[model samples]
Target: MRRREHESLTAGPVCPSTRSPRYTCRKLECVFSLGHPSIARLLTIKLGSGHAACIRFNRSGDLLASGRLDGTIVIFDIETNGVARKLRGHTRQDWKCVLWDLQDGSRLRTIRFTAPVFIAELHPNTHLKFVAALFDDQPILVDATEELVVKRNFQSAPKRSQLDMDEATEKILAQDAKQTTTVTTFSPSGDYIIAGTNKGWLNIIETASCQTMFSTHMAGGVITLLRFAPGGRQIVVNSSDRIIRTVHFPDLTGKNVDFGNFRLENDHKYQDIVNRLLWNHVAFSATAEYLVASIHMNHHVYVWETAHNSLNTILEGPTEELSAVEWHPYKPFLAAVGIDSGEVHLWSVIAPQKWSALAPDFAEVEENEEYIEREDEFDVVASEELTKRILRQEDEDIDVLTIDPVKGYGDHQEGGFKMPVLLHQDDEDSEDEIEAIGAGQYRRKSPGRGRDRNTANEATHQNGRR
Candidate 1:
C-alpha cells in the first residue's frame, strides 16, 4: 500500500476584498464585478412537457440537450433553433443528469436517480465513461456509449448505522457530501475524482487504483456543484446554503504526501439556494474567463473569476422558476430555463444595465409620497380590474397585461392609454433617463393594434366595431 503525504485547504467564497454582509463582498471596493451588456431579453425555447431538471451542450455548440421529469431526453439543433431529436432510456421517475459529449454529440449519457443524485461527471479524456453517486452509496461508473455499468464500489460508503447523528462520540469512518449534489469533472490528467454529497461530505478518489484517497466533511449546506480549475491546481464546490468553497490540490507529480489531504480553508455563504453552476461560465473580449452560477429558486446569476478568486457581476430577472443555466461557450452571453413555463432566457453576464440596482435610490420616494398616493388608487383599480378579469377568465373578453414594463409597481396605466415597449430596442438607457423620458416614448406594440393604425380609414368602412 502506498502511503499518501499531502496537505489540503478549503477557502470559503473567494472574497478578493474584505466587505460587509459577512459572507458577501462589499460593492464599491468589491474585487469581483460582473458586467452586463446593454441588451437583455429572456429568449423562450419551448420544450413540450415535464419540468426540465438538467441540460448539457455538445462541444461544437450546435446541439443543446436536456433531461426532463418524464424520463426523456430532448435534443435541440441550435442551427435550426428547434427540437431536433428525442432520446428515451431511463425508466426511472425523473431524470437527474445528462452529459453531452463535447467531442461527439452522438455519444451521450443520462442518469435517472431514484434518490436525488448527489453528483455526476464524465472522465476528462473519455466521454464514453462517466461516474455518479447517490447519498452514501457507491459511485457508479458507466460506459455512456453502451449504457453499461463499468464499476461500482461501496468500500468508501459508511455503514447505515454510522449515519446516526447522535453517535458523535463514536469513532466512525468519514463520508463526503461536499460537492456531492452535482457531479464534477477532473483535470485532464485524471489524477483525482471528487464527489460531494448533500450531507456535507467530500470524497476524493484516485483514478489509478479506483480507490477512495481522501474523505472529509465540508460544514456547509448541500454541495450543489463541483468544478476543477483548468490547470487542476484548485477545486471549487458550492452548496444550496449559498456557500462557495475552493479546495487546493498540488500538481500531478508533486509527491503524494498527504498534506493532511483534507483541509477546507475558506468559504463564502450567502442567503439563497445555489442553483446552476459552471466553470468558464462566461467569456469576455473573445477570451473565455468567468465562473457563473444561479440561485436555484431565485432570479439571480453570480459571476466569479478564477484568476483572482473574485465575483465579477450579477445578472438577474426571470421570476417563475430557474431549472438549468449555462454560458455561451465562446461569448459572455448566458441562457437559463424557467422550468414551470418552459421559458428560456438569454442574458449577457457582462456590462448589465444596473437598473435593478438603482431601485434603492428611488425606493424611498416611491415608498413615501408617490407610492402611497398610487397605492390607494392602484388598489381600487387593480381590485376592480382583477375582479373583472378573474370573472371573465372563462370568456375570451378578459384583457390582462401579459408583460408589464413596470411589473410589480402599482402604477396601473389609464384605460386605452398606449404605452411604449422597449422590448424591441435591445439597448435602453439608464433607469434615470428611462423614467425621465416619460410614457410618450413608449409606443403600444400590442398584438393587433398595428395593421388597424395604418389602414384605419380603409378598414373603418368595412368593420363597424372600429
Candidate 2:
C-alpha cells in the first residue's frame, strides 16, 4: 500500500498567484525528466504594485492570489486575465491575535495575550479552535466559541497548552526550560498538529486533545517550516540546520501509533553540507512526487523526486536570489518570486505539437531511414464520397485520454470529477493514490459555503496556508 485512507473536503479552503506567460529567457533547466516533464519554458507575472511574499492557485489552475509585501493580496483571474480583488488590512503591534474576515476585510475576533505571539494556525477541521506559538511559552489550543457575543475571547490559549500544567508549575518550568515553539502547522487532514522548536525538537500533537503524540530530535538549529504533502503521508521539514528532510510515514494511523520509529530511506535527507545553504521555502508538486525549494540568497531552485529521495532537477533563473517557490496545483509547472525584481517567474514543460497521426502519408522518425514508398500512396486523382456516411452519429462520443501518467488509476478519476471543486471529498484511497489529495489543494471561488464554513476558512487562513 502506498498511502492511508482519510477524510476529504469538497474544495478545501486554499489560500492564491498568476496570469499569461511572457517569455523571459531561452535558457532551460532539465534533468532525467523525472516522473513529470522538466520545465521547458519560463513565464513571468508582474504586479505593478508591491513585491509578492506568497502565492496560490485555484483548483482549475485558472486563477491566482499573490500576497505582497505592502500587505495587499491581489487575486488574479487567469481565465479573464484580470484582478479579481485585493484583500488588505491595518497593521498592529505585538501581544494579540486578531482574526480578520477576508470577504469584507473586517476583524472577526481578537485574543489578547500577556506575551507576544510568534505564530498561530487554525485547526484544519474547525474555526472556533486554533493553535498559537507564544513568544514566551509553549503553544496552546484555543477555543473561541465565545465569539457569538461579538467580543474578543478574553481567555487566551495560554492555559490550553501542550504544557498543560498548573499556573505555578507552568511559570517555573517556563523559566527553567525556556523551550519555545518556532514553527507550528496542521496536517492536511487537520487531525494532527506538527510543531518544531528552536532546540531542533520535532513533535506531533493531537488537535483533538492538544496532546503530544510523538517527539524526536531531528535538527541542531531552529525549525522554520513543516509542510505535509497533499497526500498526508509525507512531510518536508526546513530548519536552520540546512537540511531538508522529506519524512515518510509508512503507517498513517494517527492514533496511538509510534511515529518516532518510522523509517526514512537512506537518501531521504537533502543538504548542502559544503555551502550549508538554508532553504528559504519548500513546496511539493501537486502530485507530491516532486519537491521544490528556493535556496536562501541563491539564484537556483532545487527539485527532488520522492520515490528515491534523489535530486531530480535544478531550475536556474533570476540573477538575484529567489525567495518563495510554488508548484502549479495540477500541472508540472513552477512559480517563484525574484527577491530583487519582485517579479514572478513561472516554468512549465512545453511539448512540441505533433500531427503525424492525422496524416497516413506522413511518418516521423528521429534518424534517417531509406524510404519505401507504395505506388498507391501518391495516386489520389479521384474525389470520392464516403462509402456509407451520415451528417453525424449521435451514439459516438470522443473519449479523451486524460489520465496523467504521473497519477495512478484511483487518483485520476477524470470522469468522476465534479465541477468547480478544488479538493475531492472522498475517504477511499488506492495504493498509488495514498499520497494524492483529490482534486489537488484548491478551494471553490465562492468559499463561503455558510457562516460556519466561512469562519473556518478565515480562521485557518491566518495560520500557515499551504
Candidate 3:
C-alpha cells in the first residue's frame, strides 16, 4: 500500500441544532440527515421489526443487503429504493450457517458445526469454501464442494494438563480460554485466511490447504472484527482492547510466497485516548486511505488517515447510536444504521450540480423562489431585412451535420443498400425502374411513386408563388 501523507480535515462540523434543513447554501458541505442531513438521500431501507445488525453492498453497489436482528435478511435495490428480497433463516436450526440463493430466496446448503460459530464467511471467489471461527475452538476451513470435509487452520494448543502445574488453577484456566479463535476472515484476494482469538493472537492461514503461515499476538483483549483494505497488503483489526490496528503484510502478489519468513512487520494502532471510546464497528474507506469507526454510544464516527495514523475528520450526525457502517464500493458515500429507529442513515456530499454554477447571481435555496414575468417578456415586433441571407444566398441549404449514413447492423448486401419492391404482373402500365442513390446502392422504384416528397413540395410551392 502506498503511504498517504499526513493530512487533517479538522473542519468543525455543523452542530445538529443550528444546522438548517436541506444542507444548502454552504460551500464546504457538512453531513446531513435523511428524512431526519444528507444533501441527496438515495435510499432508506427500514427493517420490519428489529434493528439492522449488518449491511453489505453488492459488487456493482446498486443493491444493499442488510441483516436484521430479527433473523431476517433484506436485499434492497437502490435504484428503485425498494426491498428486492427478504430472506430468513435459523428459526429452529442452530449452530449452523445456511446459505441461500438470493434469486428465489431458497436455501441452497447448510454447514453445521459442533461448536457455536462466531462468524463464518464464504470465499469471495467461490462459495464452496468456508472459513469459520468457533467459540471454544480454533478457526477451521471447510470444503463444502461435495462432502463435509474440515481442516483445522492453526496448530492445536497443547492442553494445560500436559504442561507442568506450577501456576495457579485460575490463572491457568484464563490462559487456556484465550486459545480459541473469536473472529476470522478471508483476506481480500482469498489466498490468505486470518483468524483473531480471544487471547488477541492473529493467525494467518493458507486458503488452499489450511496451513498456518504467520501467527502473532496483537492485543490482550478479544479480537472482534478483521477487515482488509481494498489492497490485499494492508489490513485493519478491531479488538476488544479499544484500539484499532492496521497491519501491513510484506507480500503484494496473491501467488504462492515463502510463509516461513512471514511476519507482522508493520502495523499502526489507533484509539480514542481522550474519551476512551469503545469502537462499535470499523471499516476502511473506498480507497482504504482512511479508517472509520463508530463510537459505543456517540452519534459521531471517527475517521483516521492511514498514512500518518492521525485523526482526519469526525463525521457528526444521527442522534441515535450508529452501528454497522458500510462504505460504497466506488463512491464517496456511506451508510450507517441507527440503533434506536432502525433507519439506514446515508451520508454523502454529492450535491446537485446545475447550470446555476455559471450564473453569477446563483444561490442555493431550500425552497423554489417565486418567479414573476414582465408584461413584454414574449411580445415581439420585427421588420428588418435579413443581412446574413443576402450575404450568403446558398447558406440556407448547407447542413453542418452532413455525414454519410452508417451501415445498419441487421442486414446489408456487399458494400451497398438494396431495397426491394413488389409489383403485380397483371398491371400493364408497370415499368421496371431502379434508383441508384450511391455507389453499388440500388432502390427498386415503386410504379405509382413518380415524384419524391421534396419534388412534390417544390411543385406545390411554385403554384403557391404563381
The whole-model lDDT of each prediction reads 0.46, 0.57, 0.60
Q: Would you list the clashing residue pairs of candidate 2?
A: 16-56, 16-65, 17-56, 17-64, 17-65
Candidate 3 minimal-lDDT segment of 10 residues: 3-12
Q: Candidate 2's residue-wise lDDT over 1-466, tens digit each? A: 1111111111111111111111111113233254664555443343343334556664445456665433444555543444555444413233555554433434556666555555566556555556666654667667665764222211112222344454457565563366577668777667777778777777767766666666667677877777777777788888888888887745445466665464433238888877888887788898898899998768888888788777877887767667667776677666676655555666766655676768875777889999888889887554433322332454568668654533432343343322232233232211111121232232233333377877888889977565
TM-score of 2: 0.61
Per lDDT, the best of the predicted structures is: 3
Clash number for each model: 48, 5, 4
Q: Tens digit of lDDT per residue, candidate 1, span 1-466?
A: 1111110011111111111110100011112224432334443333332333455554334455655433445555554455555444443434255553322223244445445444455566654555666553456655545666445543344223234556644344244221233344455466666766556666666665666665667645555566655445556666544566666655654446473544555433333234433221222221335666655445666666655766666666555445455654444445666543444555543343555577755332234453335545544455788789877886665458564444432342223122122224222112112111232132223555556776977688669765
Across 145-221, the per-residue lDDT of candidate 3 in tens digits comes to 66655555564232222244455487766675557777778876677777877778787777776766666777868
* Candidate 2: worst-modelled 10 consecutive residues by lDDT: 4-13
Using lDDT as the yardstick, the better of models 1 and 3 is 3
Pairwise TM-score winner, candidates 2 and 3: 3
Ranking by TM-score: 3, 2, 1
Alpha-carbon shift of residue 29 in model 2 (angstroms) = 11
TM-score of 3: 0.63
Tell me the lDDT of model 1 at 73: 52
